[model samples]
Target: MNELLLDLNEQQRAAVEYIDGPMVVFAGAGTGKTRVITYRIVYLLNLGVDPYNILAVTFTNKAAQEMKDRLVKLFPHKAENVWVTTFHSLCAKILYTEAKNFGLERNFVIYDENDSIKLIKECMKEVSVEPLNFSAYDIYELICRAKDNLIDPESYKINTMVSHQYYREIVAEIYSKYQKKLLENNALDFGDLIMKTVEFFKNEQFADIKNKYAQRFKYIHVDEYQDVNYSQVVLLKILSSVHHNVCVVGDDDQTIYSWRGSNMNYLLNFKKEFSTKDIEVKEFKITQNYRSKKTILDISNILISHNKHRVKKVLFSNIEGEFKNDVKIKQCEDEYDEAEFVAKEILKLQQIEKFYNSTVAVLYRTNAQSRVFEEVFSEYKIPYKIVGSVAFYDRKEIKDIIAYLRVVVNPQDTVSLKRIINVPPRGIGETTILYLETLAKENKTSLWEQIVKIDDTELSLKVKNSVWKFLSLYDLLKKYKDTMYPSEFIKFLIEKTNYIKMIEENNN
Candidate 1:
């Protein structure tokens, strides 16, 4: 027996060894899911499978890195060859390789949320649309939902027309113009990474590239399978159609991303997907609850059993100690009282109950609920850390600076161009931006291209000077990019754009 199989239980070992057509591991919370996944990869290596033949896909870059680290520890030399990455990253690799086939430049940029919203707002400005009935955020959500379902703009417009006619007209127009802008600027949003790849694979032009990928990766393993959307499922199915050695590990009870269009239906009916191709599926359930005691498992099992739609499985505790502590339930008069009670109980657990080694986690339904608990914890001087909510990159000034950097990196990025065009309240206002947008559309070129040849005779002196100043500043930065280091370029931008002075004036 291999050393990797030593620590796994019967079901886990079975999953690691099952190398058939298709398999599903109904991994419950606290089960060693990553262990089974990594062990399976090792099992394939032990069987003399080429390391490059295996591909592991997870939900986040961090998880992918962790999986790579584990694999490197087990197989130091061969681990580097295995392809491990998030779905978006996988699609990005595929797209980057075949970008020229789709008329997109190899240097195409990826627009983040702020860049995407800024582009959408600029598009709205061109059409004289007000925010009374249609907001940029609302339109953004609609576009995301459409892409998640692999719905093209034309089909989305048709569907919207059949359902909501008024929004149909507006959204369809906006979606068409938005997609045109993205293509014109040679950029893609986060959703486009998946959506575009799916479209490319379905086209006959992608035959050679798809065949190369499908043949290269003989084994495919997807973690967090329950949160896959329509576009992601299609990509996986296409890639694995060649060799049906696909293994998906997930639990239906953990499907909480439906708000983002992630459907658990795909996970629940996963086997049915390959039935037409006659791929046999072996299902394994890991029910051993390693993290909780019998009392907690019993309470959880009862609570989840009431749900009508789910895979039938029991989480049985495997702990050695007899944990017969009754689950505590407390009632509070208000939110403040609840916070105080939770804070006191946490202190008692740490000090009096000798649970010093046990780290406590306070769960909240929403981010706003953290404020009351923070106040209570501060009153008691309790040391606590909030996990995963605040993102430093989401700050306003930070995004503004990133927008400037994106424009410097890729001059064709009109999304970034529009974002910082008048960010510090330069003389270029909405009317001036609309004029530039109309001129670019009429001339069939990028905003930067049109700005270089601006007809300042038609503009008022203030607006004309502002537009020229904006263009000159960008050109100066381009020249500086050749000699100045990144830090020096940032300082130059602050001084040239007067960004700091504007902030100070506003503050005073």
Candidate 2:
């Protein structure tokens, strides 16, 4: 390494030069993990590897941008050619240019949790099945797990705590149908995208591309490697087969996103998988932290040490500790009040010189706890973005509008359909839609269209009128499809659907 680049610590220096091998750098939080990754790319470039021959994957867009910035500072023109991107963004790019060969459309929409839940609810309605003691979120999780295991939904079955043979059979059936509906819309949940893409690479058609990508890239360096899911790891394994130059930097102690599908198994299995005849395996540790003070490091060590499976890690720091004595233990008065208290402390710190524009985040064990912080912050006009998943249920006006837009986008979405079915105090109830769906399927038309043409003899005249009005509103939406984005289309829907009228009269 050059003198300027050789300035990195011993761990960092080892991280940079081990560019030719399958190396795993076990870096603790606040360590120079970022610096090591950046320097590795420069080292590869210095070794006569083309910039386009290196791939660096990060977990977030912000990190991807930072990697590019760091690379550009060192090698100047080399930044533009290096592939530094989040998994989703990289997959989206691949799908945009190459997915057509794999039978996927270029313009396929990403179904965030809200879209998936909306679709799931619609399928439940279609099956005349009410959700049994489970929320839409619960079903989404089950679906995600199924996808992660690469279980083809066609032959999928749900084995759950529900002991009844009949109920288990019923959920499995509903799941099969729900998956078909997603496929019809060219939609894959986040997990499905990764899993399916892995499957695609394994198939004959993508085998050449896999070889091509691997040969094109000299070294594959992954950031936040602890956050890799099964499918992602599979993709990395395949792509690295050709070049056998993969470097991953992560701390097993920070493996905290199990609920979001991050697999701890990958880190544990990294060495065994990466070691082959042509491949070299090396391991390095970065125990020292630059970001945290000595006290903060001590606090983290005490708490994380309890995770027995975590690799033995210690955070050594020269910076002064925050507390005179380390106070590692934190007690929260339930999740909500804990957040409220945290919000108060953060707002108090906002007045300090250093705290300016430094976001004070209150991490929660669950999304529900975010509500407390949100309410407290909003009251004080503290600006913040609700990160993680889609914040549909979080926004009042947007949820109201999404209800209307979902009705327009996919009439098949059952949860919102159920919510809106009688929402306008529409005289139509649950049984009516079930019967209507059956009739619509029989006639091969929309339930709204089927209800419109059905005779009034079996139905109440009031119910008949509401169903006809619903069909007329759908017809109007069809007419104005040329004029609106999904948002404005929903705006038109509330007025045109007379849904608010139903709400107003019911409120009276």
Candidate 1's residue-wise lDDT over 112-135, tens digit each?
A: 877777778867877778978789
Tell me the TM-score of model 1: 0.87
| Candidate number with greatest TM-score | 1
Tell me the tens digit of each residue's lDDT in model 2 across 1-508: 5774666887788678776668898898888888898888888777778887889999988899988998899888866788999887776776656777888765455566766887777777777777776466677776776666566555454454335767556667767877777665555667666666677778887888767777886789899899887768878888788778889988888777787678877886788878987665888889888887887777789888898887786879999965697543558877666666676777788888877644655566777767777887888777888778855465644565565565566664444455566665657887887787677677776554565575733777877887777677766887786698866776777777676676577689
- Model 2 gets an lDDT of 0.74
- Lowest lDDT sum, 10 consecutive residues, model 2, at 153-162
Query: Candidate 1: what lDDT?
Result: 0.85
Q: CA shift at 493, candidate 1, in angstroms? A: 8.0
Per-candidate RMSD vs. true structure? Answer: 3.6, 6.6
